[model samples]
Target: MPLTVHQFPCLEDNYGFLARDEATGLAACIDTPEAGAILKALDTLGWKLDLILNTHWHPDHAGGNAEIKAATGATIVGPAEVTRISALDREVKGGDVVMLGETRFEVIETGGHTLGHIAYFDAADAIAFVGDTLFALGCGRLFEGTAEQMWTSLQRLAALPDETTVYCAHEYTASNARFALSVDDDPALKARADHIFALRERGEPTVPTSIGLEKATNPFLRAPRLAERVGVAGEPDYKAFGAVRAAKDVFKG
Candidate 1:
C-alpha cells in the first residue's frame, strides 16, 4: 500500500503529525508539541507510531517528546545537533535517510530558524516536514543563524520538486500573507491571503502548501534579487540577506 500522513493541530495552531505506511503499519511523528493531542490523532487514525522526527529544538516542536517517547517507545530521530539539546537515539545529517513503514525520508539541513533545523523530505510522496524554516508565505525569523544561512536554507527547499507538499509546523499562512500583501499588492497574494484569513475567521488550517504555490506568492522565497539590493554596502554574507528579511519583518498588512 501507500503512506498516510495525518496532520493534527495542537498547542495554539502548532501542528503535530503521524505519517504511516499501510503496507508495514509503521508510523512516525514529525513533531509533537502536545502528547495528548498527538496521541489522540494517532488513535483516531489507528496508527502505531514507531518513530519520532524532530526538526529542531524549539520547545513548541519537541516539548511532548518525553511523554510520547515514554508511551510509544518510538526511536527519536533528529538533527545532528540534537545531541546537544535533547536525548536522541540517532543524530541525523543532511542526505541521511529515515524510514517510516514504507516511506523513506531524506533529511534536509535547513538552518536559520535554529542553527540545526532539519526538514524531512519524502521525495516519492512529494511531502516535506519543515519545522519552522519555511512557512507558506514567509520564512521563520532568524533566531540563531544569520539571514544568509536562512536564505540558503529556503533556497534548498525551493529546489525541491515543485509538486512537493510543505508541512510546516505552524498555521502562519494568513499572517505571513498579510505581510506579503504589504510588500507588494500582487493580486495573487492578496487573493490567497483573503482565502486564508477567511479560513482563520472560521477556524481552519492553512498548510500542506505546494512548493509551486509558494514560489508564486511567498515573499521570503522570492528575495534573492531584493536581498542583493538591500545588502548594507554589500556585506557579502549576513547583511545582504538581512536587508531583505528585515524589510519583511517590518511589513504590515
Candidate 2:
C-alpha cells in the first residue's frame, strides 16, 4: 500500500508534511515548520509521530524540532550538520536508507540551498520530499553552496523517474512561474504558468509537482534552455545555472 501523505500550511508560506505507512501505523514528518500545526495534524489523524526527518539546518525547516520531539517523543533523523541548528537522534547521509514501515526512503545529498542539505526519495512510492532544494518552476536561493553544487544537486533530482511526485517545502510556485515566464516563453511553459496562477488565485496549494513537469518548465532545471534569455548562451552548466539564479534573485516579476 502507498504511504498516506497529509499536507498542511504552517508559518507564513511554509508547509508541513506527514507521511504515514498505513500498514504499520508508522508516521513521519518530513520537516517541522511549526510544532503547533504538525501536532494538530497528528491529532486529527490519530497518528503518533514516530520520526522527524529534517532536510537542512535552516530555522524554518528545523525550528520546531525541539518542541515536536518533546511533545511526542519522536526520534529525530537528519543530516549531521543539522546538529548546528537542532537536535538529531540519528545522522544520515547520501547512500543511506531510512525506513518508513515497508516503504524505504533513499537519502540524496542535495547541498545547494544549504551545505549538507538532503532530500528523501522513495522509489516504491515514486515520491520525494525536497526541503528547499527544488521547487515548482524554481529552485532555492544559494544560501551556502555554489551554483556548481546546486546544478549537480538539481540534476540528481531531475534524473528521478519522471512520474515522481515532488513535495517541496513552500508556496512559491506563483512567483516562480512568473519568473519562469519572463525567461522561457515556450507554449508548454505558458500553459503550466497559467495553471499555477489559477491555482494560487483560488487559494489552492500548487506543490507536489511532478519531476516531468519540472523538467519541462522549471528554469533552474532547464538552465541550458534558458541560457540565451539569461545572457550566457554558450556557458557551462554551472555558469548557465548561475545566470538563471542571478536573474531570479532580482527579478521583480
Candidate 3:
C-alpha cells in the first residue's frame, strides 16, 4: 500500500507533513516545524505517530521533537546532527533504510542547508520528504556547507526518478519563481511561473512538486545552461550553480 501524506501549513511559511503507511496504519512526522499544529493534525486524523523523522537540526525542523515526543512517545529518527537540538532515538545516515510499517524509506544524504541534512525516499511509492534541501524552483542556501556541496546534494535529488513526488518543507515557490524568472528566459519556466503565481493568488499551496517538473523548470537545476547569465560562463556545472546561488542571495527582485 502507498503512504498517505497530509500536508499543513505551520509557523511562517513552513509546512508540517504527516505520512501514514496505509498497510500498517503507522504514521511519522517528516519534521516538526510546530508542535501544536502537528499534534492537532494527528488528533484530528486519529492517527498514532510512530516516528519523528528529522532532516536536520534547524530549529523549525526539529525544534518540536521533545514536545511531540512527550505528547506521543514517537521514536525519533534522523541524522546524528539532530542531537545538536533535539533527542534522536535512531541515527540514520545515507544508505540506511527506515521502515514505517511496511513502507521503507531510504535515507539520502543531502547535506547543504545543514551539514547533516538528510532526505527520506520511499521508492516503492515514489515519494520523498526533502527537508530544506531542494525546494520548488529553488534550492537551499549554503548555511553550513559549500556551493559545491549543495550542487552535489541537488544532483543526488535530481537523479531520482522523474516521476518521484517531492515533498519539500516550505512554501517558497512564489518568491523562488520570481527569482527564477529574473535569471532564466526559458518559456517553460515562464509558463510554470505564471501557473505558480496564479496558485498563490488563489491561496493554494504550490508544493508536492514532481522531480520531472523541477528538473525542467527550476532555475537552480538549469544553472549549468545559464552560466553566462549568472556570470560563470565556461565554468563547471557546480561553479555555475554556485554563481546562481550567490545571485539569489542578493536578488532583490
Steric collisions counted per model: 0, 0, 0
What RMSD value applies to candidate 3? Answer: 0.6
Stretches > 4 Å off in candidate 3:
none
Tell me the lDDT of model 3 at 1: 93
Query: Could you tell me which residue pairs clash in candidate 3?
Result: none
Q: Model 2: what TM-score?
A: 0.98
Best by TM-score: 3
Candidate with the greatest lDDT versus the true structure? 3
Whole-model Cα lDDT per candidate? Answer: 0.83, 0.93, 0.96
How many clashes (backbone atoms < 3 Å, residues ≥3 apart in a chain or on different chains) does model 1 have? 0
Clashing residue pairs, candidate 1? none
Question: Least lDDT summed over 10 consecutive residues: which range in candidate 1?
Answer: 225-234
- Candidate 3, residues 1-253: lDDT per residue as tens digits? 9999999999999999999999999999999999999999999999999999999999999999999999999999999999999878999999999999999999999998999999999999999999999999999999999988999999999999999999999999999999999999999999999999999999999999999999999989999999998888999999999999998999998
What are the candidates' C-alpha RMSDs? 2.3, 0.8, 0.6
